[model samples]
Target: MKDIFTCDLRTNSKLPLGGKTIVFGGDFRQILPVIPNGSRQEIVNASLCSSYIWSNCKVLTLTKNMRLSVLASNIQETTTFAKWILDIEGKVGSLNDRETTIDIPDDILIVDSTDPIGLLIEFVYPSIVENAKNPIYFQERAILAPKNEVVQEINERLLKLFPGAQQEYLSSDSLSQADFVHDNIDETLYSPDILNGLRPSGMPIHKLVLKVGVPVMLLRNIDQKSGLCNGTRLRVIALGKRVRKAEIISGSNIGNRTFIPRMSLTPSDKRIPFIFQRRQFPLAVCFAMTINKSQGQSLSKVGLFFRQPVFTHGQLYVALSRVKSKDGLKILIFDKDGKLTNKTSNVVFKEVFGNL
Candidate 1:
């Protein structure tokens, strides 16, 4: 993938794998490689099939989806759903002259006039208090939001609804050591307010509000062998000044308790135009998570709160496909402009799939 990103297959003077045959496997429809601040053309150019070596590589595709095959009892519906998803991914839907936005099918849209968050909560996790401690219950359901701000809002609302002890942890936020080397840099430049505003995805916020028995996601891969990895969900059990204890709620290591300590985290956003690091706990409330983070994880039920439409390719597709059954998925579309609507945009760069 790196070779494709750099087009280095044809440009690298020193290359060990230049003579070896390699195999690449993944669904291009799932998620594309993330290139920080890279343009659409740059992203397409960074794909494996876009490299010069792709000319010599044989393209083989597997047509049958094992997931759909296993759910063969509802073959017709699933096949139609899968085709609709591919059309969105391929931008084959009826579009305006620019082909930017399309009218979402009414059958798939959930129209609501009141609070979307409240509606989504009741729809996905009815009787939440009864199953707050049951790890299996949380592992099967989650609300997917498109941005960190919206995820935080939904998590905060759900946290209030969760029945348990409330706990708050404030991060010791500061500029990185590298930023300290410059004597001209003032401490006031990176104040607590500014640091709080810099809550990028994959990094914890300045102040973390938690409650006992509430589910949270690990932000770092503390120990892969222990099933404590990024995106691993856990339920809070105890809290301390230095470490917080949580029971694993997902994966093969369910019910295992582990301690999370303060760790230094750096944001991967080159768009920030500044370099800084944060020292905070590697855990975030998991009542809701950004759609980007929910990729590759299957859920029994999904609540998609679209405060903002998806901005990139594969995001909408990934969010909608997280659930195993169509009946398990529920979407709430709400924007800042007081109106009940279900229409959204799908960004599909057709050229990216040209090699396929």
Candidate 2:
């Protein structure tokens, strides 16, 4: 009764004029709007899923895949249709312009959203500096997930094996307020100087980058021109504010420490909606987001998603190809007959394929 009757409907017909995303989903051939079964001739429609609407996208076809035998055709139809929907992204090249890429030296940092961030410390600066390829190096490895609980567990286990390893994290309340950038959520970062001697939040995340003691960038989450909607692919980019003092949402008349030195400002533009006026932070350069962050993004390498629930090979291909070339790409998951091919372990295969 929910998805069929009382679900939130987002369509060109249902939305207010000038809405950014027209998320229209329905098999017009079978379902009718409002008056059910009272249709004359139904249509198969997703007209709004057009190149003019979205940014970076790739066309993919999961149907007629010879990877499956004739026996699975009937059951596979729905999955294929879903894949078709995911693959029909029109004119997505413009979307790639959103992500602001920060080119920090590789040795300076290695970012991981998974558990056991301490494992990174062990992997890079071992007690005796050995090659990373040794199997003994991976003996304490565990799957990396974004949840704090999971990461804490991995860190705890790793501590027992490697007593010297230190777990690192940025426990900032301001930057970590929202749990997701998904769905229809409007988000903005404000750096107001309302309180004397007060600083905007995002200190922890700032410290995360500062501890590295290297030049870095910051990225914004919202795309002003494109407009942000639920799952509308919003991202913020930053260049040198990674470890700077940011007084975001200030109550006083002061800007973040990064405001003057890092982000060169004309004073007025630094107010709200920094996109309007001409302002550029020297220590920072930011773009929106690319196809890579949809699944998620990493600093250097990534395990591309190409499994069943993830559409077709095209999405995986785009995700994998986001790097300079194949050198930074690795297949993390794959599907065989809609099941994961590598189930025993989720160790992301690292490869410097000399492509990206």
Candidate 3:
């Protein structure tokens, strides 16, 4: 599909629609794209890019969030409306007292995201696979990390994960190899295809995952009740088009990213995109609570694995929000298990997150 196939959104005014089908998404409040020479103006949004063109596209607004409960979702939708017109700063992720004082359960999945591209694929490729039955063909619908080394690792891992998976490893400079082309890492000027994309060395795994439409899992911080330490899985979404210095965590690097596979959210590679956005860890366990990744989609079947539930409010709310009704929720903890009496110690954290 010729995505940027010059529809000539160039109109009477830039925002004046040139026969457009711009299914625009993403928040203008978040990260901005990193253009060469790094001008703040370069990060400007399409909302501002050519309001004229956008002003003309056939309008269709999905004000309703499918994931949140009728009440929470409605409240949020109303808030979005208020924010849309009033420009309220109501979107606050500022840390609170609960964040610092809260103590969560141990055994949180701890991961170190070193391989940027592989981590991106761990999250992105799955969703892409879900939507694009054969991704190699939909070359225009994807983004590639700049680092060739990271890209190489990703290709190897993808093949390892799905032997016949169709994908193209690309780079800017003319080369037919799968390795880091640091010299051409900033080659975003060219369009992405199965064959062309570049990335920098030591890219941040988080950004890479987000760029490729995958969520990220960072051990936000350790909250422990006993002798164990735990991590948080916060799936983030960039508020803008693209940026530089991406951070990613490759699951193929098992020795690096630490995950308690039995307690993490591991959506199959083919089922990720429908998740909207989530903390795409290399591996996820059967019954752990997931993140806001469920924001835009709906699920018929979901399994929730939770126990002492000592984590951030986001973790709790996100986990609870995964299922549509009480029947879709399942608990995977053993309160009667020995040495776990204190495991329930993370109740406050769980309660706050659960209520949200």
Instruction: Mark the 10 consecutive residues where model 1 has the least summed lDDT.
Output: 91-100
Residue range 97-161, candidate 3, lDDT tens digits: 23333222232211223543343343334444454223232211121222234233443454344
Q: How many residue pairs clash per model?
A: 0, 51, 36
Cα-based TM-score, every candidate = 0.86, 0.25, 0.25
lDDT, candidate 1, 250-337, per-residue tens: 8889889999999988888767656678888999998899888888787878888887788766777788877776777787776569
List the lowest-lDDT window of 10 residues for candidate 2. Answer: 347-356
Model 3 accuracy (lDDT, Cα): 0.29
Model 2 root mean square deviation, Cα atoms: 18.7
lDDT of each: 0.77, 0.27, 0.29
Arrange candidates by TM-score, descending. Answer: 1, 3, 2
Which candidate has the highest TM-score of all? 1
Superposed Cα deviation of residue 179, candidate 2 (Å): 20
> How do the candidates rank by lDDT, highest first?
1, 3, 2
The top-ranked prediction according to lDDT is 1
